[model samples]
Target chain A: MNSLTTAFFIAAAMILFAGCYMLVRSHNMIRLVIAVEVVMKAVTLVLVFAGYSNGNTALSQSFIITIIVAEVVVAVVATGIAIAVYRNNGDLDLRKLNKLNG
Target chain B: MSASLATLVYAFIGLPLIAIVLLNLPNRKFAEKLCIGTGLFVCIVQMATAVIAVLLLIEFNKASMSFSQFWDMHVADDAAYFSVDFLSAVCLFCIGMVGAVSFAAAGSTVRDKILNYTNMMMVLLLGMNGIALVTDLFSVYVFLEISGIASFLLIALYRDPVGLEGAFKYLVMSAIASAFILLGSGLLFLEFGSLRFVVLEEMLQAGVYNNPPLVWLALFFLVAGFAIKSGNMPFHGWLPDAQTGAPSPVSIMLSGIVEQMSGTYATMRLIDIFLLNKFTVVNIGMMLLALLSIVLGAIAAVGQTDFKRTLAYSSISQIGYIVLGISCGTVLGYVGAVLHFFNHSTFKSTLFANAAAVKNQLHSTHYDDLGGLQKQMPIAAATSVIAGLSTAGLPPFAGFWSKLLIIIAVWQTQGAFVASVALLASIFTLAYFLRIQHKVFFGPEKQRPAVKEPKDGIAIASIALSVVTIGFGILFPVLLLALQTQGVL
Candidate 1:
């Protein structure tokens, strides 16, 4: 792999790791969604890099489109659920929503 | 006839989709009847297609064929390919049957938001059917997410605190899983310059990838993604609540088909393609994960008192069994795993449907709140008993033989430690299920408010499933022969 590709890989991996960490660490619902989106972006970046390096831009571009569409739907539904939870419990805090414990 | 069978597969997928639009027509007065009618229509088409597919398989003596190959020239070169094989057809059959049952068993739950519920159910089924039939990695990911989104909405259908909370948990975790899948697929695409499973299988078989480290990383991500989606232990926190809180029919769809399609089936398909060539660290890691889920999930289920909650925990434990069977890396193990997938969907969905029936009757699912219900809801009680026994792996039931196959496979592959744990887990499974049966269905009548029999739709659904569970168990040799013919064994 070239230095530029290596750099892109490193950047994407770091961002992805950061997003996963935030997903585990964040207590707020909306923040969790943001963490997920961050991770998604990192993945998109990787896909783009793969496309560039392999010269399969069209396939990768289509994949990116699919990802974006799926991402939007997930985000919207998640936001809607978060809003519903907030309306019911009056907060977006996930810890408080633990009524159905083992 | 061949052309018609291929078209049947599309009709099986498309009818539900079309029903989604038709159910949403502007006419309000006939909406409920329209919903039921469309649901029944889709169910009939699904069953008819399943029977014909089986007949075609028998007539041809072929294991698998590309149903979409005839149309390949019409679509773009990059368009995804679909095949109707033994496994995919069986998966479709189960989905179609359970889906039909769910629609029939839905009773009053979908009555409130009939259009919305039917739409989401059809979307979920379409996604699931796609997952079973699609031939490439990207399509799997797309379809997995499609089904995942449908499930999240379905879980939140009640709009209550518990329901919304369950939905959010599912959403967050699924998002993480999807990220892993995307990253893994990207790595594989980089390696092969194609997203097709057949290509990846060939490369792995040939050991063509130059960078072993990246391949390992990609495999890890893929396995992790599928494991999370399957609701395996440590990654299964979302499942219990989601299963417990979703409206009952939604629970049937979620627990019955969605988890199987997204988790176990996907994992098996990938493992068949990638890990079969070389048993690496990924396989060992998966085995460890499987053992962990097997033991821990069973132990955890013993403590849950809520009815659906216990079933949810039981699902995790059972999933562990499926994973463990797959990890054994033996053909016998594969048979066990796939058979367990089929058996579990039948019995567990029946159990959940029964729980829904009970909930509908008594408006509660807590263990302490139910008792002596046999006289009142004999169908629920009887079906629950059969389903419970089948789930716990009682002899003469579908679950028993599959669990036996897995245990034998593990004994041969992983030795006595894992085998013993699996055997012991079966006992725990029986214990917990017995507890549910005794406390909820057989004990002295609790002086509670009287409730009516569970609705006929759910009762009929449960009965149909119960018969299949018993039939499959008794006729397991035939299934084995079919599997052998399909080259699965």
Candidate 2:
């Protein structure tokens, strides 16, 4: 692979790992949501790199736009649920959200 | 004829949109009153349209028919559009069937939030129908998100602690799955410059690609994403919690159709297009996952004390059977997988409907809170027995034929050992279901306030589903004979 492709892959992997680390370490619900968004951003980076390399920049741009829109909706819903959880538990900690265990 | 098919295809996506508009045009009270009826109407019409479309496709000897909802988008060679084949037609019918049952249960259970429930249900229907109809991978991701959002909102509708927690967990897991899917699809697009299934299929068949490792990486991500969506064994952490924590009607939707539509349907399509009879390693990997799910899910269900949780675990097990059929990579296996998909919807819906009936009356589904219910709730009890028996693959039920086909397919392709393991897993299925039957329905009577049968929509739905289970079981042989005669077998 070329230098540019190698750089892109390395950057994407770093971002993905950082996002996953945040997801695993964060105990707050809102932070968890942000972590998910971070992971999605990493995916977006990969998609853009894919398009750049494949010479399909227009199609990839459209795909990224749609992904952003959908990702925003998912974030909104996650925040809504987290807020509801906070209301019920008076905190945003993940430990408090374990009521449905078997 | 083509015009008529297009109209039918349009109805699949259009009817739900119109329903949403009509329900919201008036006052809140008016929407509340009209919501259940409108949902039921849309669902029944969808069911009819699916059956009719399948027959028409068969009679005309067409592989599939494509149509756009609004504007024709055939300008480019690989532009995305909607199409319906036999597999999608079957999925559409299953969605309508389970959606109808969900709405029926919602009629009595979700009285206060009826309007909101109806609106979300309509959106969910549109999303699932989109999944069934879309011909491209990116559109599948778009619809998956749509349906996933609807389900998360629906689960948290009451905003109870358990419901919110379940919704949060489901949201996190589903978002991750979507990321995996997007990354995979992007990699595929990088290689092929297209995400349409037909284009990908042709390219893969001609074996045209530069980087084989990148292709394998893409396949890994795609399979993992779909596997997580479908709640297979390793990635099933969110399934039981979500199903148990959602309200009963929503549980019906989640277990019966949503998981299949968002997860298994895409996997089936992926296998059909990309891995058809070629990717033996991928097929074996999928088969192993299926086996793990079937055995582990059933074993886990046996230990669960909650009714909905047990059913959720059972759903994981049944989904395993479907995946196992798909992993066999044979025509008979594909047919078996599809039939099992349909049957799973019917029987699982009936069981959840029974759970709703019990929950509506007793307000709890814990095993300790239930006993000797058969004497009081005969319809729920009797129907649960039939449904449970069907789930265990007993003869004279729809599940039996499908499970039989799947096992035979496994035996033919994988070997006797794998098939026998699948066969023995049903004993665990029977064991846990019998536990449910004894503890919840047929055990010793507990003295408490008078418990009468829930004579609401839930009871009616269970009875209707039971009839379907028995009827389909009896009629399957005739259908098989007809398929044989037509040289389809």
Candidate 3:
């Protein structure tokens, strides 16, 4: 409703944007996973912000559930793959993974 | 028959959307056959519908009659439209021919996971056709993701380490692009409270917004998101990785259809929506990218020793032609764009199939490891010539018509210089394709152990696709006319 709240929401979105971009830009697998976790939190914040702005508790509750599901499922599965890749190739740096490069 | 044909079309799309229960169905081999049968059956139905639609389209065209429908599932002021218009129906023709030919060729290559293969292929068909037919923004995103996610999974199914890497990158980049799309979509929805493309178009045209910072930002994100899928210069990083690392059959589909459909359709759709105000800037900007791709793709292809990688670069250059055509914003321009899009799918699929066969015959895809396939595989050699010639835009080929129109469109709009650059790029396209074909298939035979003709399925498949190329080239006049009648060209 106010500029302060709008600023908070915008900041939250920027944080998520920055975190995801960092994850993609980072060469380290661990850091990438950590960045992905940040994105999860950011999206949660976004849902909460939107709900709070409109006074929609139902929306926020569903948003929290979606965030939990994302963290538990997608983040976990991707982390496992990242770890496996790290173990197999002996590196966490994406730059080193060019076996797929043509 | 018409009702069943329409029903079949719906099922052709819907069945892939519904998940089928996996059966233990003996070994993977039996599963493969089952998938092949299902995929083939779907393709047959598509072909039947396409033929029937063509017959109907003929009557509609002569009488200038169109059976159109509007569905407004939202509260938008305007509706999302779907019609069996001449443009869409003709696209169905391309989809039917290519879908059938590719399935026929894929027989056992996808034998390992037949059901999954069939599912993905069917979804791909649904997604692609939906993109061609649906005239709504939200529906576009839904179908775009349907195809994009399926494509990533299909590539990942290769299970090789390289394949996994490619799939991962594709998934990562595609997710980011779609997120940008969502962001753009969310803002648009917030402003207008509707996602229907027709409604959005009306609202924008009402002078409510004129190149606002937010709209431009949304457009930028939309372009960037689609560009990743486009596999253009900067965002093209994923392409060689994905295509070269993918399985042979997947390579054929990805190189031939996926990138072309998503990128070209996104651009065309955007141009349509934005045609109200930013026509000049959009045209100039896209023309710049098209030029960049022309030079960059040529340079990249010239440097690649890996066969599939080279084809990947060639694809980039070919996409330049598509972009150049549509961006010119002329009727002839769109004609060239749509026709070339159709032509490329036919020719490039054949090339990839032949590439698969060559890799099979030689056990490697590197240029140094392959030579003189003419004697051993005459059919492949002959088909390769047709494809190569078609890509080079040689006369009497469908490609020539598309490229000629593009060059003319550019020249008429801008200058002789743009046209000259395009013409020079076509020569570059010809040179590289010829260099590879000459060395690999037409040169002196290097006696090697275990040299054999290509496998029956791939050979059969390449021939089928090559026929598509030659047939379309010969029938370019009729096809162009159909596209024009539909106003898509």
TM-score of chain A of 2: 0.95
* Proportion of true inter-chain contacts also present in candidate 3: 0.16
**Candidate 3 on B73-185: residue-level lDDT in tens?**
22222332443444566566666666666666566455566567666777778877776667666557666776776676677664667776787677566656655665565
Q: Over 4 Å off in model 3, which ranges?
A: A1-9, A30-91, B1-9, B17-30, B51-96, B478-489
- Give one digit per residue, the lDDT tens place, for model 1 in B1-489: 454555765676677777887777757667766886688678768867877787887788766555454354234323438766767777888888878878887656667877778888889888988898888999999999999999999888879887887888888889989989989999988888888877888888988988888887888899999999999997998898888878889888888878889989998898778865266566668788888887788788888888888888888888899988888888898889888988988999899888888888788899889989989988898999899899889889999999999999989987898799889888889888988888889989999888878457888889989999999899998877876787766
Clashes of each: 0, 0, 0
- What local lDDT does model 1 show for residue A93? 89
**Candidate 1 lDDT for residue B279:** 67
Preferred candidate (TM-score higher): 1 or 3 = 1
Q: What TM-score should be assigned to candidate 3?
A: 0.86
Native-contact fraction for each model? 0.76, 0.87, 0.16
Q: What is the DockQ of each candidate?
A: 0.81, 0.86, 0.29
Better structure of 1 and 3 per lDDT = 1
Docking quality (DockQ) of candidate 2:
0.86
Off by over 4 Å in 1: B67-80, B275-277, B481-488
Candidate 1, B-chain TM? 0.95
Per-prediction TM-score to the true structure, in the order listed? 0.96, 0.98, 0.86
State the TM-score for model 1.
Answer: 0.96
lDDT of each: 0.85, 0.92, 0.71
Candidate ranking under lDDT, highest first, comes to 2, 1, 3
